[model samples]
Target chain A: MVDLILGWTGVVLVFIGVFFLFLGALGIFRLPDLFNRLQAGTKATTLGVVSTTIGVGLIAKGWLVFSLALAIFLLMTNPISSHALGRASYRAGVKPYKGTNPDLYAEKVKKESDQK
Target chain B: MRIEIPQFIWIAWFVIVSIATILATIRAIVGPTNSDRAVGLDTWTTITTGFWVILALYFFQYILLSVSMVYAILSFLGVLAIARYLERGL
Candidate 1:
C-alpha cells in the first residue's frame, strides 16, 4: 500500500517539477533582460530539482541518501552561481532593462572606486 | 519486463524536457548579448541535471546518480569560470 502511494506521489511530484521547468524556460524567453532571466532560471529550476529529487527518493528505496544530498547541493550552489552570473554580467556591462529601479550595484561600484 | 503503469509516461516526461531544452537552446542562439547566452547555458545545465536523475531512475541504474552529481559540480564550476572571465576578461 505504501509503495503504491509513493509511486503515485512521485509521479505527481515529477509532473510539478516539469511544470516549474516549463515556466523557467518561458521566463527566459519572455523576460527582457539578463538579470530577470537569471532570477527565473535560478529560483524555479532549483525548486524543481529539489522536489523532483526528494520525490524520486520517496519512490525508490536506498536512494534517499543520494537524493537528499543532491537537494542540499542544489540549494547551496544554485544561488551562489546565480549571484556570480548576475554580478559578472553587470560588471561586464550588460545593461539593465529600461525602467529598472534602484541601481544599487552601480552605486556600490561607484562608492568602492571612489574609496580607492 | 513487467510494468504496471503506462510506459508512455516515461516518454512523455522525456519529450517535455526535451522541448524545454530546445526552447532554451533557441534563447541561447538568439540571445543578443554574451551574458544572455551565459544565462542560457546555465539554465540548460541545471535542467540537464534533473533530466539525468530521471533517466537513472528509469533505467534502474544507481551509478548514474553519482554521475549526475559529478556533472552538476562540473557545470557549476564551468559557469563560475565563464562568469569570471566575463567579469574581468581574464
Candidate 2:
C-alpha cells in the first residue's frame, strides 16, 4: 500500500513538472524580447525542476539528500546566471523594448544607476 | 516505505524537458542579436542542469548525482565568461 501511494505521488509530481516545463517553453517562444524571454526561461524551469526532483527523490526512496542538495543548487545558481545574462546583455548594447515606460538611458541615468 | 512508480512516467518527464530544450533552441536560433542569443543560451544551459538531475532519477543511480555539480559549475562559469567578454567589448 505504501509503495502504491508513493508511486502515484511520483506520477503526479512528474506531470506537474512537465506542465511547468511546457509553460516555460511557451513563455520563451512567445515573449517579444530577450529580457522577457530570459525571465520566463529561468523562473519556470527552476520551479519545474524543483517539482520533478522532489517527486523523483520520494519515489526512488532515500534520495532525499540528493534532491535537497539539487533544489538548493538550482534555486541559488539559476538566479545568479540570470543576473549575469541580464548584465551582459545590457553591456552589449541591446536596446530595450520600444514600449518601455521609462527611458533611463535618455535621462543619463544608465551610468549613475549602474554605479550604485 | 513502498514506492513503485511506473517507468513510463519518467519517460514522460524526459519528453517534456526535451521539448523545453527544443523551444529554447528556437529562441537561440531566432535571436535578433548576439546578446539575445547569449541570454537564450544561458537559459538553455540552466534548463540542462535540471535535465541531468532528472536523468539521474530515471536511471536510479546515485553516482550520476556526482556529475550534477559539473553542470552547476558550468552554468555558473558560463555566465561569468560572457559577462567578462561583453564588458571588454564595450
Candidate 3:
C-alpha cells in the first residue's frame, strides 16, 4: 500500500515537472529577446528539473537522498548561471527589445566605465 | 506480485522531453545573437538533466544518478565559461 501511494505521488510530480520543462522550451523558442528568453528558460527549468529529480527519488525509494542532493545543487546553480549570462550579454552590447523601459543597467555600466 | 509504474508513463515522458529538446535545439540554431544561443544551450542542459534522471529511474540504475549529477556540474561550468567568453572575448 505504501509503495503504491509513493509511486502515484511521484508519477504526478514527474508529469508536472515535464509540463514545465516543455513550457520553458516553448518560451525559449518564442520569446522576443535574449533577456526575455533567459528569464523564461531559467525560472521555469529550474523549477521543472528540481521537481523532476525529487519525483524520481521518490519513485526509486533508495535513491531519494541522491536525487535530493541533485535538486539542491540545481536550485543553487541555475540562477547564478542565468545572472552571469544576463550580465555578460548586457556588457557585450546585446540590445534589449524595443520599448524596454528604464535601461538602468546601461546607465550603471556607463557610470562604472566613467569611474574607471 | 510487485506493482510497477505503467509502461505508458515512460513513453509519455520520452515523447514530451524529446519535443522539448528539439525546440531548444531549434532556438540554439536560429538565435540571432550569441547570447540567444547561450540561453538556448542553458535551457537544453537543464532539460537534459531532467531527462537523465528519468532515464536513471527507467533503467533502475543507481549509478546513472551519479552520472547525471556530474553532468549537471559540468554543464554549469560550461555555461559560466561561455558567459565569460561572451563578455570579454576569449
Using DockQ as the measure, the top candidate is: 3
Model 3, position A106, has a per-residue lDDT of 86
Models sorted by DockQ, best on top: 3, 2, 1
- Misplaced by over 4 Å in model 2 are A105-109, A112-116
TM-score of chain B of 2: 0.86
For candidate 3, what is the lDDT? 0.91
Question: Docking category for candidate 2?
Answer: medium
How many residue pairs clash in all the candidates, one count each? 0, 2, 0
Candidate DockQ values, in order, are: 0.60, 0.61, 0.76
**TM-scores of the models, in the order given:** 0.93, 0.86, 0.96
Q: Write the per-residue lDDT of candidate 3 for residues B1-90, one digit (tens) a residue.
A: 123878898899999999999999999998998889999999999999999999998888899999999989988999999999998956
Give the Cα error of residue A92 in candidate 2, in Å.
1.4
Q: Which stretches of candidate 3 lie over 4 Å from their true place?
A: B1-3
* Pairwise TM-score winner, candidates 2 and 3: 3
Q: What is the Å distance of residue B25 in model 1 from its true position?
A: 1.1
Candidate 2 pairs with clashing backbones = A3-B2, A3-B3
Chain A TM-scores, per candidate, are: 0.91, 0.84, 0.95
Which regions of candidate 1 fall more than 4 Å away from where they truly are? Answer: A113-116, B1-3
Task: Give the DockQ-based CAPRI class for model 3.
Answer: medium
Worst 10 residues of 1 chain B by lDDT: B1-10
